[model samples]
Target: MPKKTDRHRPEPTSHTEPDLAKAKAVSIACGRRRFLIGLGALASAPLWPALRSAEAKAPAAAHWPGYADAMVIDALGGPGEYAAEPYAALSDKALADVRASGLSAVNVTVSGVGSYAKNPDETIRNIAYWNAQIAAHPDRLMLVRTAEQLALAKASGRLGLIYGFQDATPIGEDLDQVERFDQFGVRVFQLTYNRRNLVGDGCLEPGNAGLSRFGYALVEKLNEQRLLIDLAHGGERTTREAIARSNGPVAISHTGCAALAALPRNKTDTELRELAAKGGVAGIYLMPFLRIKGQPTADDLIAHIEHAINVCGEDHVGIGSDGTLSPIDFNDEFRRKHAADVADRRARGISAPGEEPDVYTFLPDLNSADRLDTLAGLLARRGHSDARIAKILGGNFARLFATAWSPA
Candidate 1:
């Protein structure tokens, strides 16, 4: 197995830096130089064909419209609590592993509860790290904030990096930080993690008070910024309230439907319907808690997706593996040590009227993280049309992005 290392950290060299410095220096030398150059370019129009050809030369396989993934964690490699290897350290084999999974894009959540820095310099360094990794694979990866950008990345045979936050705590008590992140190309924002924050309560909170006043304001601001709101770890009331309150679609980036596996983390049929009714997508997660007890087969996951589709319709269904790069078995000692911290908030309260029995173990055949390809193949065998399968696989997510992200 690959091990994590800091040596693979991304850093910009003089060669790769954008020409901002040069532009600034030239501006001091002559203000009219840049403006005249722009006017001259408009007059000549010679560069238009080159730009068009460059776009046209993008790989054809990359242009598959229905090919988009809702959520994919960088577990085998990438920055996260679960991963052993840094994203930049990934070898060609690792990259191939992702491509082989049939994923055209992934939302890489770089900021999480543990990733926040106390000092400004450290924050800058962390942001720089992410930018460098993105620059390293410009042909294979591109930062995307809107649906159009994702399509462009797909057309270019590049993985789309939808920078996301797993916790709003990092934004601290200030809404300015959220605005700042929006400006920085963050496309998705989760209001809370597993614990309560200033904005709202998490799923683990004993009382599900829904959104706080600040939380409501945050939602409006997020909407104004055109960022996709995610209710992954939010409490039930909070999730529902957010869906009701938002002007645009919201996402449960990685989760299961309660109808399949009764868990606090899973959405009820009603919630799923509401989400889809509002033009949102519900990502069917592959986490252990999301599956039925015992080793969950790939079929088990498909069942959940199928159920969600029945309730939410085709355009509202997608995949969110919630996969981690962590090598420790979920049953290992480390998990036990963290057991109290990992308790499901939904599990604490009296079971809802129709909650299914809790599942402690997972399916045998779907034990590992590399079974996405198998799942896709299974979907094909189940008589799902290519177009429908494509939506379930990634198209639904693409549509959601089109609605949520706005460059204007």
Candidate 2:
């Protein structure tokens, strides 16, 4: 990753760095310069001194009291206003609802892997786009790089957003690109999407080839930079090998338990056990993969979480809801757009097994901004202790981030 530097210093040299000057003349023409500026400004912000919130120690309320104090995080998700285009600026109401979600931080996927899999330039632009979003709403959003910032965000009531990649394509063939992205405030990278990449085989790959030599090198590079490695969509063998090879804890940022759902996107019991044994985290996603058919309810989600906790232990399990904070509108237009997007992914051979046009992503039962809090209430009623609930909500991921991104 890019070494820490003084804010006044010129940015380091890279493939894109030399072109930054040329980018300025055409800033109005293409917005590349603006992206560079946004990324620099966001990444250069001071790191918060490590600290803890007293809210965590406060007495629990009769009904879902720990949520206000707990550092709720979505390991893999988005800030949604349901824009037609990707990375479009969120709407005012969307921003309001995002705050209402009561989440301390969210690891948002800035780069996609399906269609844009091999497009490094698009990944760079996506990072810049999110930086601009954070810049535009500085009061409501802050770029996160450490656990201290997560605590600070919760204490101050601002949403902390962490940049992440759902695939390693953004880094291209060169390992130095990993450092380039780290300079842009990206902290998490998944080895592959649902299909094969240069790094490794994805879950959908029939061959189930393990991590490539490049994949191993990339894991080492990520460890050297203290960036979190994610194996969410990796093939079973690839997931095992990467987890065993990584020097530090990795994440399955968003997935379901195969024992419960038996889907390609879901991790097997052995994968979950291996992850927990290595101090890693397994984030149970709130997606259609949690079930075999029809819509998955809050009960289904709770069952998956419970099963994960049983297999991986509570400290190694958390939520990485693949859904957005803003509730989806099931209006006719949204349905049409959803169908088209699913079709496109299917055409590209990137869509997962459970991704049907009618199967909505988010749980209709927990379909509000305050879904996490609602989840905590449900867990609490189910006899889960406040401590366990807190860990599942966000503590585990926070601990993982602190451990993996330390000495930064």
Candidate 3:
């Protein structure tokens, strides 16, 4: 339903160069450091009894799931082009790191902004690549489009691989493409990115017009197919309209609450409440700008989650760290790249209304993918119940998956 455009698509297999040695080495070093830090902390603390009691009462599995993180990105290698790294290339070593992180699943984005396939064949290729990855790593990873698949993968002691699209551009203006992708196990589809498309206005757009007719139709088609609609980068009005139009539950797959930080990209309390009322989930993102600007500590992230829980209740909230796979110094390089892209589009008259010149300037303290466990610990310290912690960590997304996935 959303209109499509010709953005530069990243080449398949561009980013998949294998780095098993590097990944494994990093994993080992990090583990050692964590062990030392834990020992030091235990030894230094005079109030050992209180700390021990808290540790004993803390939920062992609440912070990190048994499996590796269910979501992954390529930027971890370094921010060049996403396609420069294929997921398959690192399946073995990546799974090792993921397993070490105590995560059980990962949602992988096959097609993203500027990397759409023109025809069905290319689409099939994308899907096939992911399918092959699942097949190759059956011992460590399993393809999962539904909650049942996730459970099966967990039971089998493997990480679940979920296919997702970062933008709807890959569908290329054809509603039928949605069906094709649905068949390919794409359980999630974002409505828009940073710019306006045929579907609806993006969050960066100044003149937010809500959902267009095509967007509404797309929502209907997605609902009929039981595909989860994600409104992460959509405008405020667009988000509300999509929520109102969707027949089934929708999701803000990875975002934060505006009330906590007032960033344009974050959702408002009212919108979050509406989403929860519809049995939808609002995944709280852990990006820096989404929290308090310069000094966004883990507490800031937890506060946003808390605020969202207060607004939408626990079952409707989850975590979606929009972290890139790379470990760039949380500084100007990343911000400059994002700003240039948005600026170029605007200069070409393809920009949204509220688009900022320096869109990525606000960098958070916890900038890397590995900080997720620390975030979970902060949440526990903030008094999150074990059940609620599980929901926020990944259970909410699991429920959404169950609601959206359709088996063949």
Candidate 1, residues 259-309, lDDT tens digits: the string is: 666656677777788888889988876555444343333445666777777
Rank candidates, lDDT, best first.
2, 3, 1
Give the TM-score (vs. native) of candidate 3: 0.70
Tens-digit lDDT track of model 2 for 1-408: 001111212222232132445434333432322232233233211211110122123233223778888989999887875544676788887899888899999998877575445567778788788889888998899889887887888888888999999888877789998888899889999889989888999999999999999999999889999999999999999999999999888999999888777779999989999999989998888787877766665667777888888788889999999877888765668768877878988898889998888766766556678888877766665557778899999999999999999984
- Where is model 2 more than 4 Å wrong at Cα? 1-63, 115-118
Q: What overall lDDT, based on C-alpha atoms, would model 3 receive against the true structure?
A: 0.60
* Residue pairs of candidate 2 with colliding backbone atoms: none
Lowest-lDDT window of 10 residues in candidate 3? 1-10
Model 2 scores a TM of: 0.83
1-408: candidate 3 lDDT, tens digit per residue: 010111111121223222556445334424433333243222322433443344444332223332243332111111112223444354344555545544456566665563345534555677787677667666766777777778887677676767776667878779998988887788788888756778888887779987888888888888878888888878889999999888778888777777656666788878898899989888765454443323233444566676777779888988766543333343345456666766786675544333454333222333333555555544443445546666776777787778866532
Clashing residue pairs in candidate 1 are 4-84, 68-394, 75-325, 82-326, 294-362, 295-362, 295-363, 295-364, 296-362, 296-363
Residue runs of model 3 more than 4 Å from their true location after superposition: 1-88, 91-93, 114-126, 324-370, 406-408
Model 2 lDDT on a 0 to 1 scale: 0.78
In Å, residue 77's CA in model 1 sits off its true spot by: 10
Ranking by TM-score: 2, 3, 1
